[model samples]
Target: MTSLELQRTNLPEGLEELLGPKGLLTGEEAREYGRDFMGEVDNAPLAVLRPETTEQVAEALRLCTEHGLSVIPQGGRTGLTGAGVPSRPDHEVILCLARMNKVRWLDEKNHAMAVDAGCILADVQKAAADANRLFPLSYGAEGSCQIGGSISTNAGGTAVLRYGNTRDLILGLEVVLADGTVLDMMRALRKDNTGIDLKQLFIGSEGILGVVTGAVLKLYPAVAERECALLAFPSLPAVMKSFAIARESTNDRLSAFEMMPQNGITLACNRVPDVVDPVEGDYPWYALLEVSASKEGSGLFEMLEGLIERLMEEGLVVDGTVSSNEGQRAQLWRIREALVEAHNDMPHLLKHDVSVPISDMADFIETAIEKVQAIAPDAMLIAFGHVGDGNVHFNICHDLDTPDGSLATRHKEVTWAVYDLVQEYRGSFSAEHGVGSMKRDALRRYRSEAELAVMEKLKTALDPQGLLNPGKVI
Candidate 1:
């Protein structure tokens, strides 16, 4: 038998025997894991290894490395970037941690929890809630996105303004290196003045450094009261003005300040079922404000009301509505979630997850819109996201009346225009989505030579073979 054919045959056989039939999958059964959450990448791997323990993962990595095969470590596969799936068909093996879903322990006193990397983010949040604590890392994909993927991307969600990103919420990590070395740093302590902080290296590395097997996550006090408001603005400046006023007036109680455009809200109300706009009339922009406190009778509702009243009188807020109960609050937040869902099926959509300084967000959006319009005059800009943290999901939808492939042809030009504008404003082209295979070019173009050199040196130091999640990040 040929060496290539023999290697392929023997690799699967060894994996099957080591991991058993249930743990290893090939052929059509493995195709589903090959695709990402957005169905953007559909290249099937040579084999899918579902390891339930760290020891199994270590052994699997050793076997794959010996065979000169590349391995891609995947969690829930809910990432927008093509980081979790195979970049090429039958050339790489996917090491998925779905079967390792388990909550190891929860310490209420320490306000910490230890969980297997495959545990769903929602499950972790529920466990923390059950312990009378809060896991503040939240987004729409919490239902299916894994904790490991969240950490790997250093995910930032709505609550990042108050609680910070997944990086801040993590106390420790348990990682398996490319050469089968297990770096178990899963300590639950809040303060460990250890050198180097090895966990930070892998947090946002996107699996190129190592496979995150588990984590010890920090938690906060459970929220006892929350106030939600949907405010309308005549322009982007007005939105920022209201945000500044809300932030200072709330006395650091602002947990979320998401911005949504009129067109985005319209699309959500039209495309997504059961999603209705809270504001009666159409304004140029909208902001979804949320404030939460741990203790009851915190007067957050009164605070929100007073802030809105002052903003309305100041003409910063043209129209607004505050949620009186949980149902109303959910309905208001549904508009934000549905806006994202509205663009899922657009074939030629240009999605930009960029971030700028809070002070420059207004100018950045306005300038980006101008730049995009210059490229594609008919393009619809659906700008929305966690404006509190300055991350905007600046997406452009194709003009439906135009030819089918016209927008696809200009995708690169439009993306570069937006990215160039982001760079000009000292903003990041890839804010929260990560630099998977999709944004690697932007990473190269935007990052300085010094920055890239440090990244490459670290990658070489940890994963010399470049086998871990190949073709991603650096």
Candidate 2:
């Protein structure tokens, strides 16, 4: 059926009065919201609805449910998985929460804060800092990605090893179910042995289960003292070894730990402006370590020094650069941040966000690298990222100087080859990134039948109509 026909035939009246003209967009106005962060694919929605209030969102969903129109939930559209974009041409409407950016309240004493779904992640962090607390859900998309999107994807960032993923940070959530029923699970209690944590259904569901409207997030004491260091390792195994010694030392104050190859660092320096290498020594692999403390007397630097010294003694780390000040530390991280942009111009880059057991990270990377090389010899390899959580962005950049359309066409081949190897290790191909429309097929192939059967049961129970964010996550 045509989208307009399906919506018009099924949607009940009176919703337009509640939303008004300003909240609705059709035709070209709806085209932009139909794409994702990376233009890996292009898909459009029939209409776009921007709801300002939770009630409005629920109301919209209820109308959508009645119409049997497939809905797409959109946040900042910074998701790499193409989850936000509509897959089918007909019977789809993109519902965006960008208008609902609001911080409901703050409970400093309880270390919790309630915020609307549309609030930018960085803004939440800044607000927590203003309250003399820490909201450590950070990532490359902090500036634009919405808090709801993070919780929906259950995002894991740099500090996940210490602070945990978005699911851990979320104490409670407000979700709009498939039938437009509002599930108010927004409680700030830390230890509530409630019957069946329903929040788990929506978290990491990637909008398939429901539309996340508001959340109660867990906060932490502000970090007062921090030590940042960049260490050079011979290989991924050495990097993993260094991580163990560092974790044991300094009482495990480790906050963020990232590992990258020298070639990746060079790409960041060359491609992104203002990102320069801090050290001179040549090394195959390097790690950026960050340790933080709540009080001034933590002696974090000394502890970091002890860890580095111990790792060096064990021949785990070959070279190390300890940042003395915040400015220097920010500069050191700029290299890491610039990595994506560094390859912005590269042709046919296959970016894989995969995770295996922490113990098997080194071997996984080595094996994956070898397989990718065998398949595409000239592919410029720039693999790096949150090594602390065993999540790595294994980017295979087909050289810019490569011949014509050949490089761009090899994306499917290279991705399949690498993902096949990643699956052999029981590793997830989509780690922090959810299986948006882009990875839905991959997920179908990867997930075991038993696992998928459970998911199907949940979908049937929660979204019997299958009207809420229809073409996503599942």
Q: TM-scores for all candidates?
A: 0.97, 0.95
RMSD of each: 1.9, 2.4
- Cα lDDT for residue 271, candidate 2: 74
**Candidate 2 whole-model C-alpha lDDT, 0 to 1:** 0.85
lDDT of each: 0.90, 0.85
lDDT of 1: 0.90
Candidate 1, 87-156: lDDT as tens digits:
9987899999988889999988899999999999999999999999999999999999999999999999
Alpha-carbon shift of residue 171 in model 2 (angstroms) = 0.5
TM-score of 2: 0.95
Against the true structure, whose lDDT is highest? 1
